[model samples]
Target: MFHIETEIRLVGPSMKTIKVSSRIECAMICSNDNCCSSSYDTILEHCSFFRDCCPSKEFSKESQTLTKISGFNPPPKDCSELPAESCSGVYVIQPENRPSMTVFCEMSIDNGGWTVRNDYLHFILRQRSYQVRFDLEDFTGNTSYAVYSTMYVGDESDNYKLKLTGYNETAGNGMSNFGGSSLSGMMFSTRNRDNDIDERSCAISRKGAWWYQSCAAANINGVYSQKYSNSAVYWRSWREKNGQKKTMMMTKPKP
Candidate 1:
């Protein structure tokens, strides 16, 4: 979730640090600091803090390092704060083989789009993981995959705080090559396929998997989505199906 990296450190900006006995202890220090987003641990029993919670920099494996999110322990019900009917954002589920291509239409909120696809895009927030039964389909409602895969969530953003951020499939069909590549072991990302910027949206593929083409994308409230996967993924996906398609969610015009 919190982009944990070993043998690396945040180079540009920093927040604070605490001396801890182990790498996990370093995470504990970050967990207590609200301002801290990303954390790094040195072999010298010191933990480094970063103001930029989401470290965009590359991790250097040469250094002794271990990093993870500081605070993410929330009850399943905590996600209840999100709207039950629709999501505040949209997300795309990409496959491993295509890399840059989205396997399913984007999920968003619109004129009751979520209601129509409830049967296929079922989301349930569990005690430890947010689960989604993702049934792939095209804008015309044509089935891309007859059956849905039960996917566990992961790879969350720093603006949001929900554990198990990586949108991964822990069960069901393990992985499939139907659309392009196997779904198993894929990681989540929110970076726009076009701009390569995180629209604060959710994405699920495998870690380190690269996309060749930037076909389409979406935007999402990291915090709200974590608290409300049903509304976020369902409605966003629906909007995409309805032809509100784009490489990314269009930036709302300023009033």
Candidate 2:
């Protein structure tokens, strides 16, 4: 599958250029090559292949950028479909009936196959059972993490409800404070899309989007700051005053 971006063209050294009868033919040629990006000139029926290219702001009525989706043939539903030996990097994936998208996979953590995506958490979590890991760093430079053996979220129709269990105490129960609270059933909330139970938009007040119940007991997506603040990244059960200096979330198919 190819993602076609209209009015934009891939800007880079062209490896080859040929006259094609249609955009489909151009995409087919690109698919066979090692190239991931290509450009098609609608008016002239010219197709240009590129080794490395991205959609540039140079808009043209006759140009369209085509990015070839790379991964397993059917496109892995998630990173777990990739070989265990696959290295950490960005790869393409397409969920059933969903659009193709690139995701960064962390292949060195806990035997690899961890998919990382903060924006589309529910979209991926809803597909299957996963083990969630949270890596956090406090302002004082102390680092800690927490892992949940079972985690998943509901669909948008369900307000992206969150569900988590199987906390690994050995890894530090950073979520102990609220992981089992109303947060488990709380719906995801954002600045513009308020599904949280709080009267105010927790996403707006906290400066980030998350599953909030009357705000939050822990918010890793919160604002990055050096001092304590309600909007700063924090895990109440871990460290509160000084919001975390760094935070990361990753998930993989549960073993």
Candidate 3:
């Protein structure tokens, strides 16, 4: 059976569009074809079919509606496998051996196809090779970023060991401090999970989860604070103070 949603529209490019008499007809056509998802415009009596295994959804103020037919193929592993016209938004993905999840894609950045990191970071990284990008913004409104050619994180059973290399110096290697002995090869540490070599839990001491050695030389997941401190978002190689206003870790399949 297929599920239908009213006043909800699929937000990506449609592979085909045709005039239909009703929503049922639209769904029937999509069900017969290999398309996994489709949408229908009630007022215009139009039907649109998408090739995306799982497309992004958005509430529509118009008469448009979307549908998801069951028994179709599984969703893509990452945003890079999506169509070139896919927009920046939340889409469903299923990494190898992992449950389906909704993740935001940064489509506006460098021709799009970037998957924002979430709790499934390890699962996504372990599924395949991906190039990682770090975006940082300071309280002064200045922004800087660093891109690595390769990044891999082991599964939980392996302590989520981090591996990074191939720094692109053109973007200013602010992550150099993190790619050193301080973080590379280190297991991830969190507030409740202690995996660092430090005598104490770095996550509890620093107020964030990260791959830490004795503590951290650079931590992008630190707490957001107005003042500089060991618990605030910071990249020591770029600035001594934790005056960061924003930070983002994004990944995409390496070209």
Tens digits of lDDT, candidate 1, 108-223:
32221111111121122222222233333323434321123123333333221122122333222312322333433433333343212233332332111221112122222222
Query: Which residue segments of model 3 deviate by more than 4 Å?
Result: 1-74, 170-182
RMSD list, candidates in order = 19.9, 12.3, 11.1
Best by TM-score: 3
TM-score of each predicted structure versus truth = 0.24, 0.66, 0.67
Ranking by TM-score: 3, 2, 1
Tens-digit per-residue lDDT, 1-255, candidate 2: 112333443455778889986544576577778777666675577888777646345544456555454558878888788877554445677766678777766565677777776556677776777889887776565877788888878887987888888777433555533444546776788888998766788899989988887777677888878778888888776776467866778898788
Score residue 249 of candidate 2 by CA lDDT: 83
lDDT of each: 0.30, 0.70, 0.70
User: Which of the two, 1 or 2, has more lDDT?
Assistant: 2
Give lDDT: candidate 3, residue 165.
Answer: 80
Model 3 lDDT per residue over 45-147, tens place: 6788877756676665454343343321668788787777554445678888888876666665777788874668888887778898988777786777788
Q: Which scores higher on TM-score, 1 or 2?
A: 2
